[model samples]
Target: MQFKSKKVIYQVFTRLFGNTNTTNTPWGTLEENGVGKFSDFSDKALEEIKGLGVTHIWYTGVPHHALVTDYSKYGISADDPDVVKGRAGSPYAVKDYYNVNPDLANDPGKRLEEFQELIARTHRAGLKLLIDIVPNHVARNYEGASTPEGKRPFGADDDVTLVYKRDNDFYYIPDQAFQVPDIPEEFKPLGGDAHPLSDGYFDENPAKWTGNGSRLAKPNFNDWYETVKINYGVRPDGSYDFDTLPQGIDEEDHNVHYQFWQDKDVPGSWEKFRDIAWYWQEMGVDGFRFDMAEMVPVEFWSYLNSHIKAKNPDALLLAEVYNPSLYRDYIKKGKMDYLYDKVELYDSIKHIMQGHGWTDHIPVVQKGLMDIEHHMLHFLENHDEQRIASPDFAGDAEKGKPAMVVSATISTSPTMVYFGQEVGEPGAERAGFGSPTRTSIFDYIGVPQHQRWVNNKKFDGGQLSEKEMALRDFYQRLLNFTVKSEALMGAYEEIHFYNKEHTPGYDHRLLSYVRWSEREKLVVISNFDAERSYDCDLKIPGHIVQNWALEDGTYSVRDALYGEENVLEIKEGVGHIPVKLEPLQSYIYAVGD
Candidate 1:
């Protein structure tokens, strides 16, 4: 149960587990086509992932699923519509709870062995493994939903119920709980038909939003996903309505799944999920990177956090919650070890490289990192969104890309680099689906494929870009600093702004913060204004501000304050040392020895 340091996480996409191929293929039958078992993965691939300065690899999409051979499975195909869409099935569709897709391991037992070996190798190389687990729902037609061979129900045994009554059943129970209407929460619902026979790719429409991959295939309960809907309110009339309100925080709190197992302590469900986590852990995984943890009940996660820690305290738990407003609740309730640092990421990248105008979104990001001392999961581009290279690469690969990488890694949180990210992999065309296949992420997986197809000249088509490599080297330096220096590792004591009034000139557009440890202190200054520059000096504790050193490894005295070893000057006026910042340029200065 011991976990790896939370400083690094590598995003491992399921189907592309080892292959560099970006194709969206189902995990059910990869071996039938020749990929062999997960243990059979080429050593070369494992080493490739290890090359990045990552301490843990977040393996996305590793659970079991019923592979579909039908072309019309997901409701879109070459014939139906969305011709631009790829044929890969979403791995989010869970088919079994006790097993993994056969394709992942030649023999499930052998797969575990291989995974164990991988973990050992990772640990030897100083890395950890984290597998993905989905708790919200299961695949449509799971087990009995299809045939005798596949008939697995939602819960193991007595957890499922058949609601046939309307008046008495909660699905049809009339009360104040069922108040909201389907028309719209605020605005009217818009009507539209499917896109016309326009060769899907022609229009180049912006990507579609994504959802968790579980499927109900019917209107049973409030339908978060269109493909599968569960019936939360069951009436005597043999009908059920998911959209109806149940007794809880909101209409969506019906908890149809929980109701199925209500008689028992539903909160304890974490044991089942935790057991699965342990199963993966036993398989030699370093830990787990939870998916949409906020969507699950907080109390349930608390149990999980405690249980996982009991087994392995070092196990890193990264919660994928995007908004900052809810981070405190999740962190407090679930005891989730880490959450995504959407704030620092957006503030540093979009606002800094793009423009201070991007700061419009800074408030949200800032609040999420409110406890700026403890770290949160941070990244520039992950599997969930577009590549920073896409919008900000700004035509010139050299300057645009390198600056972005530097900005992302230097933030306080441990950095997460999604697959193809270091090499400037473009995000999926579809942004928010449970399974992000059909998007560009799936198209450029293999090393050979990426080199030939990736348009960026900076990347040789592998997971490394020239700028990315340089930035990666910088990360290795930072990692060495983070792992070796206890003071620089997690959270800062305080962050202050050195206003222009105190100095010759200062710009509010420049986002700067000071991170310090009793033994060491470093100031991070980022000029968010892509068009303008800022000349400023951070006001620090007099003693710590006495001297400075540049990246070249040379030391100098701050004569303006005091001479070398004379102790820093803080007796009177503001100690201002001029820092000429360029547009979008960022600096990390080590203050004290």
Candidate 2:
């Protein structure tokens, strides 16, 4: 695999991205809160995103999911408010695999067509499209009303009488009638507003398992009660009913894995998901972001991902597998292109940003995952994580600057930034289903900071404050530089160790590293301290200097990020560069000839 330009994924919650309304009434209706439609992502909007240096747009919640709104007029059944999480449903609780959210279409009946148009628009803007693929579970009332011809909905032929069956799409607690969860006093399905299906009653006989694998007849409100787990041939006794991958087969590529499953007999769920992935690929989607990938079996991924890769060899397959032990297994065997670096890299960076961690630990992590660093996608904010400006996270959005600098330029892996992260969206809305820290994935809420940047659909920062504009400018500079920098796509060497020993005033709160290609060389440094600027002598090791074949003279080094120029004195194969960085400052210096 040759080195490619660094990929920057801009994850946009499709419904919320274009919503301009500020009416944030808790448990508000779609009309009251206002939902962004597929038409909202106009050509100008996509061009602006592309200008921000994004290579792919992960259009979250694009698939048809359960919602509280009544779409019965469009031949879609009304979802019971009792089982739904919020006015807008959880994107992971996909109700239809072959269709898109009707709420996102200007014409309800043309939702799929609208999404297809969005895909074409994204491609025209020179950006790839990524949508969610929740394989672990589906909506409680899973229905494929718009499934393609010759394809049957999941569990259409399953034997519901049996608690566990290889062909069954869902697990069941036989003879037990499903019961609605007990609601808390302060919370109501629709803010105490009366509705036809708000009576806390659902019609699921022989209660199926909850999305979180809860077998209780009435799942706790905190559980994933709005959805049900998909059965993947794993029995209740923890044994697989289907064939497992051969030993040591994880070393093989997707082509070999695709061939391995050629004559194999997989479970019904496996084939169903494989077909679903292929269907989307045929629809012009470039790739998929698999949600909660760890919950599903790795073998299923091997089958699905390999099949998708066989169809489109360049399809980006990103997965959300938190378990560090299973990271390599999923990448090598499951053929995943990237996995979330949440546990090791993101957590470490978050801790450092919170003033409780050491910057020294970052190099250790990078070195530890050196072999698979390219496969680990880094991000400071996503849908699930609290916003950088949120009180629950680093209260100051400026704290994300140095952290993002390290994340984006640390390695050859792809970097992701959530929508409005650049403009410092605090995500402090009360939005019905969840609390303040996270932007509600389950509610129809307005993102204030993002709306300011949206500026009534102008796609410009016309309404943003000076500070917000500066922050966005910082992000644009960093991301654009990252994508076009040859050094970032080349080799990495941690200079933090040498700096900690030889460079005076350099401490654990500061970090330095070097990235170089045959043509370009860069020395990156960051100051994580919230207070106190630092002026130190950043050192380049003698071995590296000799390797780079620098002559014994003073060379001018220019900051690639901020355009600050400095001189580097090289004598006897040791390069000493004078560096001055303010609090929470990052400098990416391009070493010149």
Candidate 3:
């Protein structure tokens, strides 16, 4: 449970990572906008990713999902367009827990074997593997293909007559037939292509509840109508049908949580996911990235995550849980390793990037989450958010430098960077299923900026513009230093407040902090201002001066990331260093004798 090195996670949308197709036609078929296969992650490609100082690679959308492609030759039925999101489908709408997306394999029938090969390749490259697991819902037409021996696929044992049976895998609407959501004017199934199944109908008897918990037979167009919610022993009237965790269990760790559930029986849904996790662990997958983890009960997590850790103590368990109030429960009792820090840090930093918030707000957030900060992972861009260089975001990749530095260095939590974020992809592609601000998760399209680095599967930066190469170099230096810097893994104390009051010319647009261990001391500073640089004297506090056991003398200091050498002068018991911070600049200086 003790974190040693700072871990960086590189998230690559699996379907888009190596696609070289430039035909970005909206609503184009897979033939027009080709998909990246599992085979595409060559040893060279993985080496390029590992060179970013990443410890893990989260292959987004790896599971078998409902899509509009025909795969009858591979024993998979064609999915109805009415319920599929795009030519490629929403990765979250998983249709089979036992298999991977056929679209990612060179041979559809050997899809699982190909993915196993990928897992081995990733580990051989000295990087770990992390894949998505959507526990809250499944594709509307989940197949559960390739079920293991002596096990039933989900809903195979369900009683369709009951609305909420304790052991039923999915909820049912007793007498009503399933109805597809009303199609919005802005979208059409297959982009109005004339397919037989695109007749504006999806057949289902006694429709299950929509993924968003919508009870309507025909959900609204905006609802998560393509997915069906899983029933985890919680009934229609909101009563728990299974055993609950002990009252004080939230205050304990996973070991205790696991012990508590040892003798007790859990809902069937819990068993389903537990088996799935073990299946991947057996395949050597290092961890998982759970989707909408908060929607499912915490007891289930305690049941599953502890089971995972018991098998492999080093397995990483990252999740998407937005409720700050429940953070402790998930981390402590539920045994989760990390959760998304979007609401607090990402939201505040985003405002600063867009010219609204001040750097002063950053410390307040840190102060509040100090107890659980390391358990909260930091990210600048992911599948769910706008790219840092998008017009709707900061509008320039240069503007993200300071924000990225702050997010990465402010905590010991894992740092995540989307595949294209380092090179400033603007997410401007007009992919068929979504808008401009966010990358399309539902369509088959190439990522122009990231594709440049792919360089026709050479996995080289040959096609990058000069500016892009520079940006990527900045990332390389910052990220590479983080994993090796002992101070980053130790203690942290912010000097932003002290400097605001004592240092002349210091203002809310600039912030400073110090990180130290017995062997290393670092001065980290960032300028949040977009248009103005600052010339100021940054002071190291007397307490920190004492912590470092310094005297009235000079110490050689140099920026570890960009090599700005300077001298740190300690007069009496206080330390002062003159610094020049360019607009949106950041510095991480190593203090030495």
Report the backbone clash tally of model 3.
Answer: 0
Query: Model 1: what TM-score?
Result: 0.65
Ranked by lDDT, the better of candidates 1 and 3 is 3
Ranking of predictions according to lDDT? 2, 3, 1
Score every model by TM-score: 0.65, 0.98, 0.98
lDDT of 1: 0.45
Clashing pairs in 2: none
Off by over 4 Å in 2: 1-3
Q: Quote the lDDT for 472 in model 1.
A: 45
- Across 556-583, the per-residue lDDT of candidate 1 in tens digits comes to 3221111212222343433434577676
Report per-prediction Cα RMSD to one decimal.
10.4, 1.3, 1.3
Clashes of each: 36, 0, 0
572 Cα displacement, candidate 2 (Å): 2.4
Which is better, 2 or 3, measured by lDDT? Answer: 2
lDDT of 3 by residue, 118-142 (tens): 9989999999989999999999999
